[model samples]
Target: MATSRDQTLSIVYSSTATRPLNDADLSALLAISRRNNARAEVTGMLLYRGGRFLQV
Candidate 1:
């Protein structure tokens, strides 16, 4: 009985960082992202490598 608008959705995003992020920077970014996503009731995974980011 679900319409398109009522269905769960998935997204994939990729980006390149202008500058490399250090451990502390990555940690901080993750903390903030987790907090924001939690507040929005959103869940996904993040991957970073060689100045690139992938979110799903």
Candidate 2:
């Protein structure tokens, strides 16, 4: 994978109001990450392909 200056790193949960990730989505996905702290983590390579998904 590659990194970019404008690209961002993220860590989201199903109940994350800020991350906007769903529990169903997490269940069928592949992920690798490191711990930032309790109830907070960091994620990488979250590819957002074309879709009707609204992330805000």
Candidate 3:
């Protein structure tokens, strides 16, 4: 019998928001990101702090 291995890849990145975003802006961003991610089979987390963003 033979065994097979699985392969996977990952990347991490961060960026700063060019402008301040209000509640509405944040909601819109989440909605758009969720749709796009679902289609791309991509899964990750997002963190917001002091106008900065970190995604992995």
| Per-model TM-score on C-alpha atoms | 0.86, 0.19, 0.82
Q: Over the stretch 1-56, how does candidate 1's per-residue lDDT look in tens digits? A: 89875778899999999998999999999999999999987889999999999999
Better of 1 and 3 by lDDT: 1
lDDT score, residue 18, model 1?
Answer: 90
Task: Enumerate clash totals for all models, in the order shown.
Answer: 0, 0, 0
How many residue pairs clash in model 3?
0
Per-residue lDDT for 1-56 in model 3, tens only? Answer: 44332445578889999999888988999999999999977789888778999998
Candidate order, TM-score descending: 1, 3, 2
Arrange candidates, best lDDT first. Answer: 1, 3, 2
RMSD values for the candidates in order, in angstroms, are: 2.1, 11.7, 3.7
Error of 2 at 26 (Å): 0.3
- Give per-residue lDDT, candidate 1, residue 5: 55
Model 2 C-alpha lDDT per residue in residues 4-53, reported as the tens digit of each score: 74567554423223354566655444332233332353333434333223
Better of 1 and 2 by lDDT: 1
Name the lDDT value of residue 4 in candidate 3.
38
Candidate topping lDDT? 1
Model 2: lDDT equals 0.40
Error of 2 at 18 (Å): 11
